[model samples]
Target: MPFLDRLQHWAALRPDANAVTIGAERLSYAELVDRASVRARELAGESSGGPTVLCRPNGLAFIVDFVAAVARTGTVAVLDPGWPALQRSAVERMLQGAGPSTPPAAAPADLRDGPSDSIFLYGFTSGTTALPKAFTRSRDSWQRAFATSAAWFELGADDRVLAPGPLSASLTLYALAETLSAGAAFHTLERVDVGDALDAVAHAGVTRIVAVPTVLRLLGERGLTSGVDAHALTGIVSAGARLDGATLASVRNWAPGATVFDYYGAAELSFVSARRLRPGEHRTGSPTAVGRPFPGVEVRVLDDAGRASAPGTTGTIFVRSRLVSAGYAWGDDGSAFARTGEWCTVGDRGHLDVAGELHVEGRLADMIVTSGSNVYPQEVEVTLLSGLGGAAAQVVVTGLADARRGTLLVAAVVEESGPDAPAVTRADLRTAAADLAAPKRPRGYYRITELPLTGAGKLSRRLLAAWITEGDPRVHRLD
Candidate 1:
């Protein structure tokens, strides 16, 4: 069944059940369907089924607008609320010029049976240029993803999922859709707030949460301090960034009843791989190893020549799956997403271990060549986070302009601070980083109070590199 096609079934089965909740606002399944049906009619009359731009904040309105737009095979371009007015205007203009590829239905269908290839979303991601790149997703791609992930994550009608991020973020939006499609109650905050998230877990009977590692770390750490009861949570889905050992440990301690499932994926490719960490089970071996291929997804590590790489040999990671998007809507600079036959790649570098576990090194663009040796920052960063123990909360490795080595490998460290956080020094970091090859080790280290993050809450390596180059005051060099 299509993603939104399940809505009527859910509404008929549980009309009075809570479908979506953000803060005090609540919408039952029946109410959601009725409101969206009316809104879809209004939208069909206003415009000739053109693509709609959704730029609102996290609230019931965003959800209603999105459901209404996509229910009739209408394409929606989601824009970040944090984006500047000028950037939003430029994107809106670009979307207007591009327009929809396929004409939408003249009126909303009683039960939408749109073709699988019909585009429903135009998700934007930062690219090589100033304007964010747009990618199109068909209804079938998300429907497949919903089925695969829902079963893997153990999400069902009884699960009350909480996603505290903004609705504009793909992670949270997908969570809402998945929860609604399963006839489960969806909970979220008006904004990203650890206190509110913890409260929901403690009081709102939240059974599952889907968020990035940063938000998970915050909720875990703050919940521990505030004595928030997270016994109701049964699952934690971590994605959008690397889940460091410290954050994983904190989450485990904070929500002992919940199993943590960290997955690796990209916007172009939905879900590539995932691993479920049961309670009291620690992730062993290489920290870079994400997990095996997701159900119905094929993973391959290809070298520059497009040949498959041997086990443990780092190469470009490629995926062949029904969950992949319909390529970029516009701004195809040829540097980011590309395809070879049935396989697609975002230039992510990784390898499959002997046990078939995938270990992601980093993106091809983020690879640092220093002193004639190639270094993936993710490898060095992982080593630092694990090696330093509780001394480092986060680490970002980047290359700086060098006169001799072409580019100097360096790292910015966010020291773990608190009564329980262990003390660390430059010497300690250097000693910890000895696990890495001499060339892969960072030549210098800087202390940062906070890790620079993008609007989507993932670590921004580009912004961090700029900070080092521009000598940002927040980043201080360590001896």
Candidate 2:
């Protein structure tokens, strides 16, 4: 069943149960349905059943508006609330111009029986230009993903999920939808606050947390020091960026009862692969391993010629699955996201090991060519985060212009802080990266107070590069 199709069932089965919670505000399943129905009627009366723009901050209202828009129009565009005024206006203009010109028939009274193949979501991905690229997904794709991810993670009606990030982010939005579809309670913060997130896990009976690695790290550290009880947390789902070994260790220590899972996915491709680390189980394999393909998904590593690459041979990663989005709605510059027959690739380069585990190197656009050798920054960043043994809280690798080597590989690290945090130095980082090829190693190291992140909370390599190029005072060079 589609996501909204299950809402009525949940409302009937658990009318008084909390369906969505943000901060202190909450709506029961029945209340959620009623509010959404009211909003759906309001939406139908306001505009034609065309695309609707949702640019609100994380809150119960955003959730209600999203469901209402989806039920009424079946097409909703989510924009970051933190976007600059100019960018927001530009995106709104683009969405307005791109929507259907003719008005569709009146919305149905039920509002929950839209066709499965109808496009329900329009998500934007960070782009090279001033405006982000918009991508659309059919209701069927998300319905399949909701089922697959819920089953994979063992989410059920008894679970209370906390996704403490902006709902505008795809990861958090999907978490809310997946939890609601499973007839479970969903919790989030109006603004990302570690104290509030810890309180939710401690006092709200939150059974699962779905967030990016950065938020997870903050919550883990704060929860540990504040003595917040996380025994109710059964699962920790990390995505949007790679989860470093230190953060994973801290999260395990903080939430000893929960299993930590790190998944690799993109906005265009719903879910590619995931790996789970059971409580008390230490990761013992390749740092880049992202586990097997998700159920109903086929992964292929294709060389430049489009033929499947040999095992352990790095190539462009492609996916064949029903979860793939219906391509871009607009802002397609052709720099990423392409298809060959039934296989789709976003130019992410990776390889499959002998055991069929996928290891993502990095995106082709982020590859650095230094001294005639190609280097993927993700591999180097992973090496620093995992190989350094809790020495760095975060790591970002980028390339700077050079005279001799085409590009100079550099690294910016946020050193682990606190009484027990390990002491590290430039020499230690170099020694730890000995396993990497000489060309792949970072030639320069810099220290920063914190990792630069985008509006969505994912680490922004573009911003880090800009910082280095502009000689930002926040970034301090290390000898």
lDDT scores in order: 0.85, 0.84
| Model 2 stretches with alpha carbons more than 4 Å out | 100-109, 127-129, 370-373, 386-389, 401-407, 420-423, 433-435, 470-473
Query: RMSD, each candidate, Å?
Result: 2.4, 2.4
What is candidate 1's lDDT per residue for 99-134, written digit by digit as tens? 552233334346353577888888988643388989
Number of residue pairs clashing in candidate 1, backbone atoms closer than 3 angstroms, sequence gap of 3 or more or interchain: 0
Error of 1 at 58 (Å): 0.6
Query: Model 1 compared with the native: what TM-score?
Result: 0.93
Please, what are the lDDT tens digits per residue for candidate 2 over residues 384-407? 776777778888898888999989
Clashing pairs in 2: none
Task: Work out candidate 1's RMSD over C-alphas.
Answer: 2.4
